[model samples]
Target: LIVCTHDLAVTLTQRPHHLIEYLARMKKRVTFLHLRHLYEQPRDKGSPYIRKKVKIGGVEVRAIFAPFPSPLLNIFRGLCVLLHVLLFDKHRYRVGINQGDPWIGFVFYILRAIGVIERYVYEDLDYNPGGHKNWLFKRITEIAEYYSIKVSDLVICVSLNLLRLRNRWRINRVIYSPNGVHLSLFSRAIKKKAHPPTILYIGSITEYFGLDIAISVLPSLLKKIPEIRLIIAGSGYYLDDLKRIINKYPEIKGHIIFLGRIPHEKIPDLMAESDIGLAIFPPSELMHYACPIKIFEYMAAGLSIITTRGTEAARILKKYSVGLIINYSVENLKEAILKLFMDGCLYKRFSMNSLKFSVKHDWNKIFHDEFKEIESLYLEYVLIHKRTVS
Candidate 1:
């Protein structure tokens, strides 16, 4: 399989990592082509291309971290993919993962057309255009995504809403495969620590995640549990804004700890120390069709969740009773926070429920079932064609 993604799997563990890792464990011939942007690349760079055996959570992430002599724009990334297939890897792949950037998605689809790969699997992780604010980039991605979906042999959507939306767009080959977590990597449900009943908010520090609203209510939460802590991991554009919001309440200043851009390996330790795993994506079109991987990761860590309505995380909690859902308000946020930390029995129940839920949503199990279903469907379709010919 040839996997193409914009994110460096070795650094930030994401959707592509799980599938690539699964393929590697199965001993398949896998060559991953990924991106390393200007901001992320080293200052004294020797070569533009970096192909090495990198590891995530101690498991090897074999890849060609490709970026040409310029910015992380789609055009350059597309050129890198061409270089990788033509001059670098030079081997035909059975499965071509049209994963990450839309520019690469079109390239992979073309590769499939030319027999560079036998099948094209379009990974509809997110509506890239919807997430982008730039008009030109959005239009480019929208066109690329439309063509990719039309030409793909199979399409995997990360959420049910996305699946339905894609199907409505006339994609019959699409299926739902929500974001999953590596069970072995994330230590599940360590007993609640005695000091500082901690609430953890990890992943991209973006505005839509609803952390600001959660933090705004912290002053009220402090009235009951004065020593309660909120540890925020990961860096994003919203870090400065979040800090400004935190500064509004100087009383809760000591309670907040910011550990920006954590390594993948250190995440489990953070989870182990945390009392609650937090995800609160506010209502939006993009978020509505979103499946937050953090929800599964939190469950894998056996930490109870507190999320907002109209997200996949909320639906998961609604089904499993693993946590509470709050509207985008200070009062509800305060109430939900108190329940998880203050109510021992309820917290235990939610923790146990999360543990059980995590097992079912493990990356290994999810991929196994998904691949099995794909194989079965292939076989059934082939048999029908044979019968028709006979």
Candidate 2:
């Protein structure tokens, strides 16, 4: 059982897709129940939304998201969370909260009231949304983090940096499960290329992702290679900033395009239309811990990648010999893109190597591995519960 604040069907994040796909494949042996705030919750409805709780293509599945309420209407959401736990057989269900917000305390309070969910898992996806330097939010976050770590049976963090907090709470089951991509989807994208020499960038244009780097480099790149076109496939708080940057560069004014937000399934088509993928996250302490899913998607599409150094994605590229890793300078990026076009053998090698490497790390296969471990843990939990009850 998975209990989260975000609607699985309406909002598409990596976590929802991972949970939905995993449960769908293992439904015969595993029952899944996804809980969310509500289906009507206002969402970006663009690149941010991945999948929904609704059945896809008439497939009836148990991993469904139940919408509760927004904070304003969540005065009694605790009871709702409790009622769902009571509705399910305790021994057959495992509870997990996708987002570790302070309000989740209300959900767990309901779970504790019913004595149905024995173990709770908290997933920490981000360290801070706004700057961590804000005193009030920082204090609130610290307190919330403390409480979550103290109560949770397991804390599944996406980065190793989060693991540093494990010692403070005496938690032993902390695990690192980085974001991943669907390799099969990318393969199809590469196979069906609609645009030649296309350049694509998908994901947040936030201060962290450094879409500005691409915006700065693109004009010069276009000057060198007039046929080049760019596709910016995601949106965030920094979209306006990125637009300003792009507009400042007259050479790339008409060559660059923004697709706004797109569906996860639609990404492959967009990737297929591009020959090169860009991931130019800025140089910051925050970036050192990032594991961008776009790199894998780029590799799967067989596109030569241009990205910054000091990221897990760069390490993977280096290890697999799939793409070029470079610094975050605009001059370096421009030079790299030019080299990718001029050096045919290197680009071909990177493209072929990327396609081969991406197959090994597809989310479909990764989901199986994670689900198997979760199932084992669930069974172990049941055995311990029975022993205590007996």
Candidate 3:
């Protein structure tokens, strides 16, 4: 069973899509419980439970939806889960995978204590203890995180830096599983037109993502390369602020285009049409340890990457010669963009290297390797438990 914070129907990005698709392909029996808050009130006000049967990769999957707005809703959802476990799960479930949701982890811990679940895995993709604006809320969530980490049989993290928490948390088993991309989907031939060179920025439009810096450097870039254009995709809380900043610079407005939140399927085509990919993130603890999915997707699409320094993705770029890393400043970014645009050989080399590096980091390979480790650990635990019982 996989429990996550987003509904699979609304968005299939990040952890939810990757794990569900991989499990379906492996022909494993998987049930996904989506505990997401609905923007509008659910139609069934009496019963805020919704169920769906969906198919991914031709494999049938059971999806359950529950409202997760408050503590009361979470308690109700826990009861729903307990009922499902007792009535439907006749064969005891061997593993439960919870995606950093403390409430879900608490419920699974209860199930494990009752012998319904043998063990549970905690997947932590992001380590943002101080991300919430509400200090009380942040502290509560952090406590929940600690509890989840303590109770989990196996902890899976997307960054190696997170392994440092093993010693701090007294955890025995931790695995580093970085983000990956679907190579085949992004294997379209790069466009070979003599039009204006396009620099593309995809994913969320948040302040920390450094899209504002990209916008700030565009005026300087336009002067050097008159035909260069900037394309910004995706939407977030900072979208209006970004638009306001752009409005201040009417001269470069024609050179910049904003494509609000794009569908996941259309990203590949958009990448293929562009010359460069921007993976800039602000210099912060959270970003320094992050394995951004956009970086891998850019590589798979064969775009030369321009990213901020000190990130895990930047380390991979440096090791593989797949992209250029610059200081998180407007001047440095402007200089790097101009250098890449002016030098044809350097751009070609990085573009080719990006594609070559992506072959090793495909989603298929990363998940297969992690799954093997998980199985081995489970088997070892079973053997030890039997010996102890005897």
Q: What TM-score does structure 2 among the candidates reach?
A: 0.79
Give per-model TM-scores. Answer: 0.85, 0.79, 0.88
**The candidate that achieves the highest TM-score relative to the unseen native structure:** 3
Tens digits of lDDT, candidate 3, 17-135 = 77777887887776666654546432222221234655565444554446655643654655555566677667566777787666566778988898777788888777655355566
Among residues 3 or more apart in sequence or in different chains, the pairs in candidate 1 whose N, CA or C atoms overlap within 3 Å are: 189-301
Better of 1 and 2 by TM-score: 1
Cα lDDT of model 1 by residue, 355-385, tens digit = 8878778888788877775666556656886
lDDT of 2: 0.66
TM-score between candidate 3 and the true structure: 0.88
Model 2 has a clash total of 8
lDDT of each: 0.74, 0.66, 0.76
Error of 3 at 386 (Å): 2.8
Residue 100 displacement in candidate 3 (angstroms)? 2.5
- Between 2 and 3, whose lDDT is larger? 3
lDDT of 2 at 353: 92
On the 0 to 100 scale, the lDDT of residue 239 in model 1 is 89
Q: Rank the candidates by TM-score, best first.
A: 3, 1, 2
lDDT of 3: 0.76
True-vs-predicted CA distance for residue 339, candidate 2, Å = 2.9
